[model samples]
Every structure is written in structure tokens, then in C-alpha cells.
Target: MKAKVFIMIMLFVLFLVGCDSEEEVDRKVQDHIMETYGFEVDITYRESLNEGNMGDRIYQVQRKDDPKVEFTVDLMGMWETKIAGDNYEIQEEAFFIGEKFVKKYENELSKLKISNVVFRKSSGLYIETSYNSTISNFKEETLQPLMEFINLLNSYKESEKFEDNYAELDINYSNDKSVQLTQIHEIKTLGQLKEQLYQDLDISNESLKAKDEELFIELENDLRKLGYQYEYGLNSDDPRFESFGCFQEFYENGECNEGYRMYLKGDSLEKDKIFELIQFLNSHSSLIFQDVIISNSKDERIIFEDIKLIKSMADIDTVYSGVNESLGKTILN
Candidate 1:
């Protein structure tokens, strides 16, 4: 009789061990949440049984650090038999903080609209102006040249003798590759800046003029070798050597149209030649002058428009997009 009682006790203990309890599941979920988010959490599980012994269990988890943040995990189960089958399957997982969904709460920056950016060149300052009342300053190391240019402008601003350069920049933000930029500089200030840059290069105005005349001859010879005829002329109104422009006309299908108009400017004609030659070599592979006005043909216009600058600005837009993505992942997530 004692042997029979011992056997029954052993069987009862085994049955209790075989049954899956809500406490066991809650402990597993609590451990998982703490390991994943570095937060201690409390998990409570409740189960309901159906007619065929198929039932669902809901695990409600609350962050111990913040009771307001909570989530739920739903587990579905099916029984092959009343006592033997306890096959549990996870039905759904959801997270919430207060009344808001966790996933939506994490990606808040994805909804941000970046409207405009203001680039100030004085003292190397590049500031992302207010967006939703938030202004951000860029890292100085990343924009050294821009900061230097801004510093130069600021220094000039403090100097009473140096005239202020009135400049205007028109930037057209676009969704596609087509971007337009127009920059206008005061003629006097532009001339002064050119003179200062040339002085730094140790090239006098007269020497630069002579070098330009030589470059024109070499350019014409290069064009002739490439089976092209060119006409070179200086704008009579702006008699400066830098104002020289070349025009090439090609007769195609009995119609005469301008083929290429090249202009060289700046302190060193040699530097300009090198740049133009490199560009000419790569012209076949890419668009050489995609909406870029290299120089002003007439003295009346003192504008410098570069497609390359537009590309640089586009890169800034990309950086902003990355910033938004990072903010979403770190702060909201």
C-alpha cells in the first residue's frame, strides 16, 4: 500500500512539471524584453480555452522603469488531447507607449519636412536654419573651405576701407537631377577679389594678359587638329584679357549653328587652360556645360553660375536626409 502511495505521488509531481504555466511564459518574455531594451519589465499572461481545446494567451508587458510604456504579445495554442497536447504558437506581437503605437513613435523624423537651408559664408558659418523652430550648426571640420570663405567675408566686414561685396545667390531645390543656381556679384568687388587672388598667385595683370593671348593660339591649334574652325574675339566693352571668348560654328545639314563657345577667366590662364583641357577630354563621357554659365559675355553682367556648385548643394540635401534617418533610429526608435 505504501508502494502504491509513492507511485501516485511521483505521477502527480510529473504531471505538474509537464503543464506549461502562465508564470513560466511571463518570465521568458520579461527576460527577453530586459535583454533587448536594457529595461526591466513585468509580464502578465492570461489564457482562454475554446470548444476544441484551442485557446489564445495574451501577455501584457509593462516597463518597470516607466509603467506608462507597455506592450502585448498574443500566443495561440491547440491541444491534440486534454492533458497531453499543449502546442503553443505565437499569434501576434505588438508594442505601445501610452496610447501611441511603438513603431509609429520610433520613426517620427520620417514625417519631417526639410524646407530650406541658409548658407552663410562669413567666418566659415554653415547653419541649417530653423525647421520647426530648431536650428542646427554644422561641424566646422567638415566645411573648412566654406568657413574660411565666410571668415574672409567677416574680416572684410570689419574693415572700413574694404568695400562690401554685394552678392545674391538663387538656389532652386529640385526632386530630380535638374537643379538651377544663379549667383550675382558686385562688379567692383568681383574685380577686387580677382586681383587679390592673382596677387596671391604672384602673376601680374600684364603677364596674365600675355599668357592668355598664348593660350588662345594653342586653343585654336588644338581645335584645328580636332577638325574644327574657331573664331576668337574680345568683348570690346570689357577689354580685359579675361573677357576673351571663342565661338565655333559647325555646318550640319546645311544649317549653321553655334557648336561650342568656350571662355577662360581667373588669375592664371595656365590654370584655366588645364581645367578646360581636362573638361574637353571628358566632354564626350559627360555633359560638359549642363546649365552652367562659366563667364559673363558682357561687362554689364557680373554673374558666375556653376553646375558643380549645384551638385555640392545637392550633396548637402543628401546629408540632411541622412540626419533625419539617424534621428528617427536613435531618438524615436
Candidate 2:
């Protein structure tokens, strides 16, 4: 009983010491940032790395003055620390101006939701929108230096500085490709640069819709050719049901959060059509459909197959995607 009490007391003392040490580290970091940058800060988060000379502690610092500005700092030695990242990487009031500017033209941005926008000053706007033909043109237009557009956003301050020189378009597709635009500074100024942006976005949205429609038509034709009279893209009253591949209605992860279904054309399922359709559906696994249903013409009473695609735009390899059969979601490689 004496030994147990001693051990518990030692553990409690160690815990208090650990807590005190953490408090000291936090104070040291906070003081170092304030002293160096002349700005108050909040330690957003800290990480303890395995290998470091003075200390393994790393901190993500957020400026009290500029909420958008963030940088990494490494603690070195016993209480010494310095900024290890470009603290001014996102400056020029980019977040302030970008948010303000975008708000002015809220109605213009039909597809480009505010959340999908990342306005990095001097680096142009990074938008996580879908891909289409206009993306190519957007590449051309935006690549010619974002100075023209940045000037428009900055004009409110009556400053004629060309800040934005690059543009990045993140496409949330299964392929997962990013279209970055970098270009030489052009001398000409486009007063209608904002208009051009909206114009390109509109075209892109239209083109994407047309592409989906074309694909739908093609799928129909292909199914008919396979001798399967079927109905594709059914709707449901379930709140969880979502038809995937819609840029207008994308999830936070940038996936088409839509449900899909294909049914036999008539109440009675033809064995040949069912066979062809089942084979096709199994092979038609894609990242777009989060949940899919394959049913007969009768009703939900005859759900032939149910599919769930697990994936995220940030990392695709971490997900398991396949058609489960006989298989109460048979987990197979």
C-alpha cells in the first residue's frame, strides 16, 4: 500500500511538471514571436518532431493583427525560437481585399462559391472549381499575369500596384489534376477583368453541364446497344440521396455528392437485360457516386444492388472502391 501510494504521487508530480513545462514553452514561443515580428500572436497548434537540434517543438503561429497570415516557427535550444517559414507569404491584405471584392460581386459568382476561393495575395486566386473547355481558355486568360485582375481588386485603395501574378485552378475530378496559371506580365490593362472571370466561369459551367448531358446520352445509347432497356438517374425523397458530379452542389471534399440508380424499363425484368445491366453496373464503379442503387422497375422492394464509394479528393489511395456482391459489403482488395 505504501509503494502504490508513492508511485501514484510520483506520477501526479510528473504530470504537474509536464504541464508546467508546456506552459513555459508556450510562453517562450509567444514572447519570441511578439518580440521578433512586433505583433501579438496565437499559437494555433504545436507539433513535437522526432528530430531537432535545440527542440523538436514546432508551432503554427497566427497573427492577431492579420487573421489570414500564418507561418511555422521552430523552437531551438532552451526557449529560443524563430520563424522558419515565409510569414509574409500571404500578405498585401489579400484575404481582406479578396473577401471584400468577392462580396461585391456575389451574384456574379454562380458556380464559384465563396468557400471554394482561396485568395492568396501576389499569388492570384486559387479556386476549387470543376473542369471544362473554358478551363483551357481560363488558363490562357488567367495565365497572362493576374496583375490586371489584382489591380481591379486593389483599385479600391487607389493603388496601381500589380500584385497577383499567378492563378491556380483546382479541379475536383476523379483524375485529380490542378491547373496552375503562370504568365509574363502584360502591359495592357483589362478594366473588364472581373467580367471576363464571370464570363469564363459561366462558359465553364455550361460546358460541364453539356458534357454531363452528352455522357448521359452516350450511356443511354450504350445501354440500348447492349440490349438493356433501362432507366438511369432516379430520384428519391431520402435526404441522403444526392446525384454526384454536380459542380453547383459539391461536397466540402469537392466530390459530386449524388446518388445514382438504374432500373429496368418495364415492371418485369428481362433476364438478358438484367444480366447485361448488372455486369455494366459492377464495372461502372466511379468516385462520383457516393451511394448508388440498382433496382427493378417495380419499386425499392426490388433493390438488386447497393453501392457505396469511399473516397476523398485530398487522398484517393486511402479509399476502398468496388461493387460488393453476395456480399454484405464484402471487403476485398
Candidate 3:
């Protein structure tokens, strides 16, 4: 009878150990990922019994704040990582925004691509970036600590202790010019983050406005040199302007079919003057300058009914006179 009881106790202990072993696998995997990537994760494990034997053990892992970004690891099989949800898609979109932001001020910023950001309790924050063929040229001088601030108000998960956060920036680029960039920032306080985000946006807006003003001045000078008296305005809010490409192929070859209408309050209203303006532009190889309507001070509208016809009518001899004169002077010297 004692032998029978001891056998039963041994079986019970074995059952408990089996259950704990399964749970231990899940915990160890989660802990490994947390330590490797510095992300806090929630993990759950389940085991199935088939034919009176334990089946595959499944582990589900999720980032603390990003439940949608979940992964499943099977300990019985090859232990392959499987991802679910739209986390990759969301991260891709954020990467595109980061790419544009970097390109907008590339001359001032480093040439790097940002991939994604990871926030951690132990290591603070980290950014992940990848390059295709080579590394990026990122520097601390360009990306100030203020630029690393990321607002988590609209994030997948909300945290009460957000202020105990730091940030990491990742920049990736390739020799082929492909880049991905991401920024991970710790949340110190919701209000503080919101305020800092708004402040940064405001500063960026002001800087862009200043750059636009400078470009407008340059454009005005060019137009004035071409004998055009006009008041010009920029339609930056127009969606079409967002993808506008003022290249020769876009205007002449139908590669880019979009058109832009420039509204102007000008002094010139004569047909001859309009023709001269068109001819001059053509001589300067402004082939993409089409679909433009010039309105004068008297509300007179001038349109280039046939851009090709106007281009053909421009005098080649007159257009090349300056070039020929320069060549002649060079020859004489």
C-alpha cells in the first residue's frame, strides 16, 4: 500500500513539473526578447494533449503597449517567429513619414533612413534603422535631443508611468540610397510631450515659411528679369502641388499629366507681349511651363492656346545671339 501511494505522488509531481516546464519555456523566450530588444512584453503559453501525449507548446508574445503587434513562437517546431496584426503596416507608414521629414531638411540633417522605434524600461528608448548596401551618416549635431521626442498619446497602448522615459534614434541607409529610420522616445509626461511636439511642429512650420519666402524672392527676381510685372502667390495648401514635378519630361512628354495654374496680377496684357514671354521661356528650355493663365491688372486673361505652336514660332537666331556673341569674344581672345 505504501508503494502504491509513493507511485501516485511521483506521478503528481511529474505532472506539475511538466506544466511548469511549458510555462518556463514561454517565460524564458519572453525574457530573452525583452533583454535583447529592450521591450517589455506580455507572454502566455498553452499546451495541448493529443493521444494522451503533450502536443506542441505555443507561446504568444505582445509588446506591452502594442497589443496589435503580436508574435507566436512554437517550442515544439523550429521556433520560428510569426508576427500578426497591422503593426508592420503601421510601422511602414511611420517610416515613410520619417523619410519625408529627413529628406525635407536633408542638407541640414544626416543622410539616414529610420526604420522603427522601441521603448524600454531598462534601456530607456531605442531606434531601429536599416540600410540596403551601406551605413548612414548620422550625427548628434543634426538631430538634437529635442528632435527625438515622440508623443505616445495616439499610440496603441497607454501607460500611466510615461515620464520615466528616454529616447533612441536609429538611422539606416544604403550605398544605393535606400534608407529606413525610426525614433523611440520615452514619455516623461503626456502634457509635456504634447507641448514639446506642438512646439517642434511650430518651429518647423516657421522655418519652412522662411524658406518659402526666400524661394519666392528668387522667383520674383527671375520673373522681373524676364520683363514680367506681376504679384505672385504660392498655393502650398493645394493637394496637386504636393506631387508637382516641374521637369521637362513632365510638361512635354506626358510623363506627369498634372497641370498647375499660376494666378498673376500683371501689367502686361498685350498678345505680342504674351507671345514674347512664351518664346523667351521656350528659348530657355522651359518646356514644362504649360497650362498657365496670366491675368493682368485690367482683368485681361492670356492663355497659351497651343504651347507647341508658340515654341515653334520663337526665333532661333535671336535666342542664340548671346551664346554666339560669347563664342565670338572667346575666339577673338
Candidate 4:
């Protein structure tokens, strides 16, 4: 009689387990989060329609009572308890805390490919949060810190700029998003990056600063005529740039010489116009100018990228170029 009762109980347990296989996967996910993240949670699964990861089984897990405390775990191999990554995505998204911050900055954040942010939901305050650039041997790996700085700048609105708490920054980039990048990068005269990169190769008969001032004045009028505006650091009247000399070397040679990051864009600028202006800068320059970044000011993306080729502006059809400091000039293709 005892054996029979034990057998019946075992059979009943098996029957319960066998019923509803989908619910079993849910339990496993919930258990995985609880064991792994120490959060007693429920999950909402989403199907991704993205090209590379089509039909991605994305698990959006929320703390049982608190909805704000949420994160995503990608289940690979169809309920095999496999995860794509545990560290990278969350650490990168560390500053995105709640709905208000996310909603306010959605349009701006989307440019960074950050469409949504949800943090450990709390009654109190908390937050969480790629340089695809390839200049100065700066692979995505070496420039993580710089990328973080750029991310912080673009993630905030004008009024809420300092609301996100970060440690004291050593970056030279401007806090004011409205400020043009040209004005803030450095002060001094820079007609082209090569003049400063190889200071010994000075071809200037006049003060490079004076030349820069003259050149920009002429360029500004022409830019406006072409519906373009200097997006970074070229505000001639701003007092911050009063001391800026165009001929100074701010970065180490060859490793990271950002020669004249003068991004020209306008509210009415179209994609074709970016190429036109870049080509204009390319062929028009008297000095050895490389790494002329033609970008969408609003998006802050390199419309043209550098591929380490060696081509002149006249031959530049698709790629961009930058001086290697050690190797002189290389192009992007």
C-alpha cells in the first residue's frame, strides 16, 4: 500500500510537469533571473524582426512588484537556457533609469541606436547607460572612454544636461550642446590639420590663426549660400575661441591627431549636399588637409568614413582620408 501511494504521487507530479510545455520555459526563465540576478521576476517575451537576429526570443524581465526594474535577456536556441551576452549591453546602458529620461531623449538617443532605456525601477532616483570611428589607430576597443563621453553629451537635453550624475570628466569637449564642435576642440589657427601635425613643415607665411579666421569668414558665407553651417567650434565671435590658435597640436602625433573636426551642416542640408561640401573642401584647400569629416550635424554621424586609403580629394569618390601622423595621409573607402 505504501509503494502504491508513492508511485501515484510520482505519476501526478510527472503529469503536471508534462502539461503546458510553454509554461515550463517561462518558469525556467524566471528561475534563471532569480538565481542569476536575484530578482523575483515575471517576463514578457518579444519577437525581433531585425535582419541579423530575426525571430530573436527576447525576454524582458521585470521585478515581480516593481515594473521599472527591468532588463533583457536574449534566449538563444529556443528555451535552452542560453544567453547571448550577460555583461556588455547592460553595462553600456547603465545610465538609462526611468521613463521620463527615456521619453524626453528618445529622438536624440535613437541616433546613438539607443531606442529605449529601463532601469531598476525604484521609488527613488537611479540611472543606467560606439565610437565606430577609425582614426589614429583608434579601434572601437581603444576608444571606449571617449565614446562614453560622446554618449553622455548626446543623451541629455539642453536644460537637463547635468542632471545625470557622472564623475568629474577630464574631457575637453563642451558641455553646451548648442556650442559648435569647432569652437570647443581647441583654440588657435588651423586651416588644415597637417600644418599642426607637422609643425616643422610650416608653410604659413602669416599667422595660421589669422588665415583660419579669414578662411572661415569666406567659408561661412559660402556655406550659408549652400545651406550649410559650421556645427562645431567655428563660432568666431564666441569669447571661448578668442585664445584658440589654429596651429596648435592638441593630441599626440600619429596616434590621435584629430585635424580640424570642422563638421559643416545645416537645417536644410541634404545627403547629396554633404558630399558636395566635402568635395568642395577636398579640392578647394591649399594646404594638406586630410580627415575632413562631412557629417549630419543633427545625427552626429560620419556621413563619410575613413578607410585608411591614399587618395586625393579629386579622386575621392566614396571614401574619406586622414593623415596617419607617422604615415602621412590615408583615405577611407
Better of 1 and 2 by lDDT: 2
Best by TM-score: 2
Residue-level lDDT tens digits of model 4 in 33-56: 767766676666555423365335
Cα lDDT computed for each candidate against the true fold: 0.34, 0.44, 0.40, 0.43
* TM-score of each predicted structure versus truth: 0.19, 0.36, 0.28, 0.26
Candidate 3 C-alpha lDDT tens digits along 107-143: 4323333333333222433344442323211222323
By lDDT rank, best first, the candidates go 2, 4, 3, 1
Q: Which of 2 and 4 is ahead in TM-score?
A: 2
Candidate 4 stretches with Cα past 4 Å from truth are 1-207, 236-259, 268-270, 285-288, 295-297, 303-333
Superposition TM-score, candidate 2 onto the true structure: 0.36
- 273: Cα error in model 2, Å: 3.6
Q: Write the per-residue lDDT of candidate 2 for residues 88-195, one digit (tens) a residue.
A: 445535555556655664554433322334455434644343332233223444323343333333453344344454355343322343443332132234434323
Cα-based lDDT at residue 159, candidate 2: 49
Q: Which ten residues in a row have the lowest lDDT in candidate 3?
A: 324-333
